[model samples]
Target: MVNHKKRRDLTTRSVLIVNFNNDLPELEKALIPLNWECASACDLKQSLRIIEQKNISVAIVIIQAGNELQVLNVVSKLQHTTPDVKWLAITTQYPIPSPYLKKKLATLFIDYYHTPIDWGLFSNSLGHLWGMSKLQIESKKEVREPTLPQELVGCSEPITNLKKDLKKVAIVDNPLLISGETGTGKGLCAQLIHAQSAREKEPFVIVNCGALPSSLIHSELFGHEKGAYTGAERQYIGRIERANNGTLFLDEIGDLPLDLQVNLLNFLDDSSIERLGGNCPIKVNCRIIFASHIDLENAVAEGAFREDLFHRLNILRIHVPSLRDYREDIEMLAQKFLARFAQDDSNLRFTNSALQAMLQYDWPGNVRELKNRVLRAIVMAEQGKITERDLGLKLTNNNMPKATPNRLRTEIDTETLLEALKRNNHNVSAASRQLNISRTTFYRLVKKCNIQW
Candidate 1:
């Protein structure tokens, strides 16, 4: 036994001693000089209750020669229930234990001490365990509470409604379908849902169905065994497998080939999938979120998409509004993008005329287009203030298009369309005639451009 004349301050530290024996008093006496607090329990049940009631970070279990089995059983239960609590062991007999028992003890405890323990070494080990426990707690806190990226930047009514819906949907684990026009940030909405979900700490994988090559879409989604196909060098784990225990965001889901849609539907029906070449079914636990700009109902009717698959995916739906629907947020969004792109150029500001032009012009490309224009203007603007001209907007009242005969015939110029609309007093039929395009084509352009009357 060792003794110290000077008492060190360690009131903040706590340890639980289970099955304490005659040696416990000596240990307590040694710890008291270090100002360490100790709680003792005669049984595992009592120890568990004490652990729950106290903020003890370390536990020391004492084992007698014949009571090894009892002590080991109790320690195993405690280890499962309170994994965060670091454990140490003290035994009266050492070399007499069975090999299995010895292994079990070694595996469970950070360190073990036999009879005639070194008091100095035991004290240092306890301090080390406490410090390690603190570090692990801090690390878990950082992982569980992360600062997510800022993607949704608007406070408009539509945006507010969307946020409310997201909060409600996040708590429930189900397949979500997001429908909107192109560039409406459906992918971002998927990301927001996953970030707020219970599985936030898990993986969030994205797959652009439209971007993947038709020949490889199946392989990419369902993975492939080694030598399953030509040019296959090694086994591949698909996106769905990669997202297990988390979320799988499939953007432009409408573009998935009809043949593959059936396979996807089967996977959705039963949370299991068969790899491209493998015969065995692999179970995957991932929340599926699908996004499509095209109308799935129309696609189903046209035989371009499967009706059953469409209905299955449409169970939990969210429709993101086009940028024009929330015009109130355009200025704020523009300013936010300006700040992002301007960087250290603090003096850079959008002119009143530039803001007015942004409000008046139809943003067909939605938020994506706005971001692009703002980024372009920041690089192109010569003066401190970004003007309407810098954003490629005509200063005239009608904002008519400057004639460009060589421009693509399929491309509908913003100025030309706006001038036609103004000339026809926003009459859809007359505007279509003025542009010399069919009514359907004209209306599509209007919708595509996000033109608002």
Candidate 2:
């Protein structure tokens, strides 16, 4: 038995005891010395009600020798209802008779004690379980704090409007279609919707339709039974099934093949799917959020995409704005990225010229491109300040005279211009920024100078 004087702190800690066959007195006597409070439930149903009503970190289940099957059923339901609570089982029989019952016992209990209980050891175990449960609860709280929708990180009017739309969409369970240019944070928008939804605690599974190979796409999205195909070795759970009771984000929805689109539409309509080579239909409950950079409407009109499927997914829609449209937030975004990626050098900062260049450049790749440039600059910068040069922006004379209103007559050195173009990976927007000339002027200079690499 635990020393009564040493366990004065246990008075505030309570444990729920689910008794079968009036097995509470001995356990009560053992726990009393530790100054612990106990709540008793005669059956599993009552125990579940008690758990729902109270704050329970641990449970003690007293089981009779012959009622293992009943006990197992009750315990299984109780475990699912109060998954955070740690359960400790006590059996009167030292050796459980059946192998199946013993296996079930192992699966249900976090720890167990035999009838001729070692009171001291059991008390110690309870304390350990309580400590672990508290730690786990705190860890979960920490994880949830960072995933809030405010982390989406934009302040422009388009971003503000999008956030409002996300909040409205999150309240109702509906299939959502998110359309945006590539790298315009469509995936992030889907994540925000999931985080803000009622199913935030459940899984958030992402499927990149474009990245999956055509041959494996069907099996990958809908799963496959063992021996379903030539390479099958084991049964696999598909993304839709895995996201049951949560959210499923399908990125690059336009890239999903026409045949697979039919299956997807069926699943969306019925909330069920049939595995490859499996006859039975399995039901899944998950919110669907589809993202597409391509013009899906165009695909439908061109007969490349199904019109019916497009209409089904177009129920609720959100259009994420490109970074160019929200240029006001660039500096804020750069600072946020710098804070994340420049932890090793707290003093590092972006120079005014660097910020100016960033504002001037048309980010064709959107936020993704900005993040990449900022990350690269953090690594490549040596003077503690990130400059336009560090970000691959060149300084050119913008005041150069033009031979014609729509053309350039200034003779830009061919080798110098080619070097700048090569440095910027031949990206016209970036190359023009480096040369400090307008994109139109740069194009005309290239044509007039007849520069070719």
lDDT of 1 by residue, 1-453 (tens): 112211222245778988745445677777767756788888765776566555568998888867778778777757755667999888777674678768977799998888787878888999999999979964652232233365788999999999999888888888999988656888778878998999988988888776566888899899999889888889999888888999988877877889999999999999999887799999999999998877889889989899999989889999999887888899999999887666657699989989888877766567877876776566457669898887776455765234334233225445556766776555554555434343444555566566676
The parts of candidate 1 lying over 4 Å away from their true place are 1-148, 395-453
What is the C-alpha local distance difference test score of each model?
0.77, 0.77
Clashes of 2: 1
In angstroms, how far off is 400's CA in candidate 1?
15
Clashes of 1: 1
Clashing pairs in 2: 394-434
